[model samples]
Target: YTSALHFLNTKIGKGQIFLKFDTVEHDAEKRLLAYVYMKNKTFINAHLLKHGLAQVDTTYPCKHLAKFTNLWKAARTNRNDAEKE
Candidate 1:
């Protein structure tokens, strides 16, 4: 987990990040659904999902929920196929 975080931080660099909050509450335990955009060019969340580094939380409501689900499923399928070989 630490290594993953480090890798993410490196990728983020000093670029501007935009966070779209899904909720108003600032509780630490609550997971806020937000898409992290870097320099208005990359969708960080989708990249993470596609690389199998993140999982889709179906309980949350988001505009990109379906896209995230599909990316997750494809990543899992690819991983499974690779393992079988």
Candidate 2:
């Protein structure tokens, strides 16, 4: 997680990032889900997912559930493919 966060920080590199919270209410743990968008309009969550650095928590409902699900599947597939290679 630390290495992944460091990679994100290097990529962000003084650039501005905008966090857009999901419209759904916070979970029981009071954790608010959000999407991190870079200045260039890139979705940071997608990047993390693609790199296999993040996972989808289907237990909680969110606006990006479908997207996250797809991302998670793709990440798994990519990891498997790389391992096979």
Candidate 3:
């Protein structure tokens, strides 16, 4: 089972990419998966990540999936703000 996941969404030359990995089981099919998405390359995930791949720009599982919800709100707000401007 994947302990953590990584992803990013931003404008201007998205950095990073999704990488496959194995979990504690160390099985072929059930390899751990990690994706990076940032220029800083501050990769984030259950396990340590490699260079180039970036984290999701959020705290690990903040409040249990909280990061996702927070990101969603931030995206919505950004969209609204962009329209206004």
The candidate that wins on TM-score is: 2
Q: What would the per-residue lDDT of candidate 2 be over residues 1-85, giving only the tens digit for each residue?
A: 9968887988797899998976655777888677889989999988888778888877756788788788889989988999999
After superposition, candidate 1 runs with Cα above 4 Å error: 23-28
Question: What TM-score fits each model?
Answer: 0.78, 0.81, 0.31
True lDDT of residue 16, candidate 2: 95
lDDT of 3 by residue, 1-85 (tens): 1322232233223555544332332334654434433454443442222222323333222332444445555656666788899
lDDT score of residue 42 within candidate 1: 88
Total backbone clashes of model 1? 0
**Per-candidate local distance difference test:** 0.79, 0.83, 0.39
Candidate 3, lDDT over the whole model: 0.39
RMSD score of candidate 3 (Å): 10.4
Please provide, for model 1 over 1-85, each residue's C-alpha lDDT reduced to its tens digit, 9 standing for 90 to 100: 6655775888897778888665442335765657788886688888888888888876655778889999999999999999999
Output the number of the lDDT-best candidate.
2
Give candidate 2 regions above 4 Å deviation.
none
User: Which one wins by lDDT: 1 or 3?
Assistant: 1
